[model samples]
Target: MNEWLIGLPEDQAVFVARVAIAFVVCLGAVIGSFLNVCIYRIPIGQSIGKPRSHCPSCGRMIPWYLNVPVLSWLILRGRCANCKAPISVRYPIIETLTAMLFLMVFQMWGNPAIFGLVRLQEPLLIPVYWAFAATIVVNSAIDIDHGILLDRFSLGAMPIALALSGFFPGMHGESVWTQGLIDSAVGLVGGFAGLWIIGLIGSLVFRKEAMGFGDVKWMGLFGALFGWQACVFILICASLLGAVAGLVLLLSRKAALCSAIPFGPYLGASALIWLFWGPRLLDWYVSLIVPAAL
Candidate 1:
């Protein structure tokens, strides 16, 4: 990378890099704008594109100027221009969150080169993971709002992940693309089977539905994106998170003992964690469990 910039002045290189980062942030915000549509439309089977953005209370079409992600919300004071009705803060929040998350991923994974041999092919993974993160966020929002995960988003991403696996260089001391695909397959099957089995057992013991099937699908999808090894850590992390949060809700009377909580958000959050920390977390676990193996 330095060699590519060898002739360029240091200031120019820095300027170019900053511009590239800013572009990513802007793009992320736009994607978040689309996500707001998805969050509102997907649950109702509405076409995300046909109607364009409009105010629900006044039924007035939202102008392009008023629809510019987070900035628009701040400019309008979080109210509809036509109706003056308060818009949910979720709109700007999602936009800002998506932008921040994109920046975070770039900071963590962005380097001069990604793949050892295919330098150009490596940076493509950034957007790949970005879409995955977006899908997870959208799915989590839906699950939180509607208590369901769309199969179209969760299960639909599997084939894309599987295809991407062919190009994904395997990590964890493996570099073979075929090995990467195999890891994804293992993760998918293992996650689905593990969740299904646990849910089944829980239901049998309690004589009620202990878990939603949507969560199983979402987990399976996550496993496909990462791998079977990651599924273990992700499930462990999500379960603990869900348990702690559930207990808090119960204790605070926010929810009843039998109330169902959306589990997708926990899973999504865990996957994001694994996305950045999977390798380090696995290394730490292995070191603790098998000190002599290394």
Candidate 2:
């Protein structure tokens, strides 16, 4: 990477890197705009594209000038241009969140070779991770709004994840396509079965459906993208998160004891945590325990 930059002046290099980063952030915001459409339309069985963006209250088509992701929302003052009806703040929040997540992933995994921004690693992984993050965000948002996780987002992503793993063996930290595919398959089966078993046992103990089948499938998707090892770690993390959230809700009297709460967001959040720092944290935890156990 240094050799490639030898002929380039330092200031030019810095400018180019900054531009590339900005481009990715903007790209992510644009994708997030589409994701908002997916979140609203997918569950409702509406076509995401055909009608174009419009004010739901006034039924006025949104002009492209007014459709820019975060900027447009701010410019519009969070209201419909025609109706003056207040729009949900979620739009800009999702767009900004996606943009920030994209920048973080780029800092962690991006290669300047793709666009001459950062040191070369695997540039392809950048877009793959970006798309994965976007999907997770859409799923989390929808689950929060609807209390359901769509099979299309969970089960639908499995095959694509497997294909990506096979093509980019680095996805599974493997050198060979076969190994990557095998790892993904193992993760899919393990996560699905593990969660299903747990849900079954919970139902037996609680005398009701203890977990949504949607979550079981979503875990499979998680396994497909990550691996079986991640499945265990993420399950633990998500469980802890869910417990804390449920406890808070109960104490606040916002939700009754044993009331159903959306678990998909916790799962998605834990997966993102794993993407950012799970392996490092896991290694640290093991290092602390090993000598003590010995």
Candidate 3:
């Protein structure tokens, strides 16, 4: 599919590639804009679709021209035009982060089979990873804000992920849907069960709910998209992150025994890490463990 692109003049190819990359980045920021809507409305049971963007401080409807992704926030000087209330920097941050993550996914997985050549297969898979990252962003923010993961996004991602795994060969490491579904199913079940066991043990030992049920479902969604190996990586990474952050909070005396921290953000951050480094890390782990197994 990309043979022609490969054959193009070097200068022409560079130009085309740059243009395409810009498009992808722009799309990502736009999606991030919608994600901000999701982050805010999903927790409050508000409809993201019906209401136009408005100021939380003052309920004036934001004009469409003033709602342009990252630019609007900067243009408004980080304040609401109507109420003069300060806007949260997280809005632009989310949009920028989404755009950056989108670019990273494209650069990493873009034209995976043919490193430098642009192809149809590459662009298709970019969104799969981006959506994965975006989910983490939204879910993490919600968890941090509310101390509970919302079922709406996490639960909704499951079917979407499975459908992609079943049909999109490019998304599968195997590059085939049959194997993709099998791998995805394994990851889904394994992730759900693994966390369930941990949660169960924690609850029994602590005489309290150690982990939220919402987190279990969230991991299941992640498992379906990236498979069991990635899920495992995410768990390991999240654990380390949680431990470090928890210790820091304890040392600073900012966190108390009864004070609860949201685990979802750590999990999401770990997933982001794994998204970029999972395959290489998995290979390294196998190399270390394979000799013992043999």
Candidate 4:
């Protein structure tokens, strides 16, 4: 732990931690508010930047104070102040989840050098990651609801991912801009082609669509940001998680074995895990398997 994180006495440490937690919570809430826009607009073919948020039921533009993330929902009793129409709990939940992810990313990389070098210092990165996560969340949710991943959300994320990976030193192994470009290109090719091949083979054998194009593009985005190896790890982890989830759903009679399950959420979840814990998990897996092989 950093001295600043641990230098305090036990009582003081608790206070410090609480303050940090509160800051993270506030950040998450704000990001969550924006993510709501992305979620609603991306699917409906609306411009996220052009339209100001309004009550879906009444079309009343939300006032600043009334749009204060989770607090607004609570204060309004989960109803729109303008029309008294019940608000979806999804807003608060998304906001809170966004905040938690932000805090987790902060805690994972505490150094200013890493943050600064990786473009983490920018306010935009916070929302960027939130949007990235939101893309996965929205896609997964919609897929679960309707058995499809919307192209607009998944495809829209590619350029943003490319731009971030291109400039961020931590995302690319080398600090040089050129190397970052190369890494990103390699990542994109590796990610897309790898999954596309798998999808093709699976479809040929099963005589149906085994994987969607949205998933291919999603993996490519992950690769462009995280690199080819992390993309592979993400794919493996997602496959494992999806398989287990699918089995559970089937055995419980919640879904038929043939039912199409959205693999995007698992990919997103695995990508996040890889982002934070990739090295540690890799080492642990190597340790386990190497010893067995030896």
The candidate maximizing lDDT is 2
RMSD of each: 3.3, 2.8, 3.0, 4.8
What does candidate 3 score on TM? 0.87
In candidate 4, how many Å is residue 170 off?
3.4
Superior by TM-score: candidate 1 or candidate 3:
1
Per-residue lDDT of 1-294 in model 1, one digit per residue for the tens? 535644567687677668868988998899999999999998998999889898999999998987898999999999998879999999999998888788767656564422123222355678887888898879989988899999998788888877778677553234788887888788789888988998999999999987899999888888888877778888899889988888898888887642555778988999999887777788788889897765
Residues 208-283 of candidate 4 have per-residue lDDT tens digits of 9888897898788888877898888999999999888878988899876425667777888898888768767888
Candidate 1 collision pairs: 187-228
lDDT at 171 for candidate 3? 58
Q: How many residue pairs clash in model 2? A: 0
Rank the candidate models, highest TM-score first.
Answer: 2, 1, 3, 4
Question: Model 3, range 1-294, lDDT digits (tens) per residue?
Answer: 356767888787777778878998898899899999999998899998978888989999998899898999999999999889999999999999999998888877674333553333555777678778888888898888888888777787788888888788555566777888888888888888888899999999999998899989888877887887777788889889888888888898877632566788888898888778776788888999999899
Which whole-number lDDT from 0 to 100 does residue 137 have in model 4?
Answer: 63
Candidate 2 clashing pairs? none
Candidate 1 segments exceeding 4 Å error:
1-8, 113-121, 171-173, 247-253, 256-260, 291-294
Compared with the true structure, what per-residue lDDT tens digits does model 2 show for residues 181-275? 99999999999999999999999999998889999999999898889989999999999998888889878887764355588889999999988
lDDT value, candidate 3, whole model: 0.82
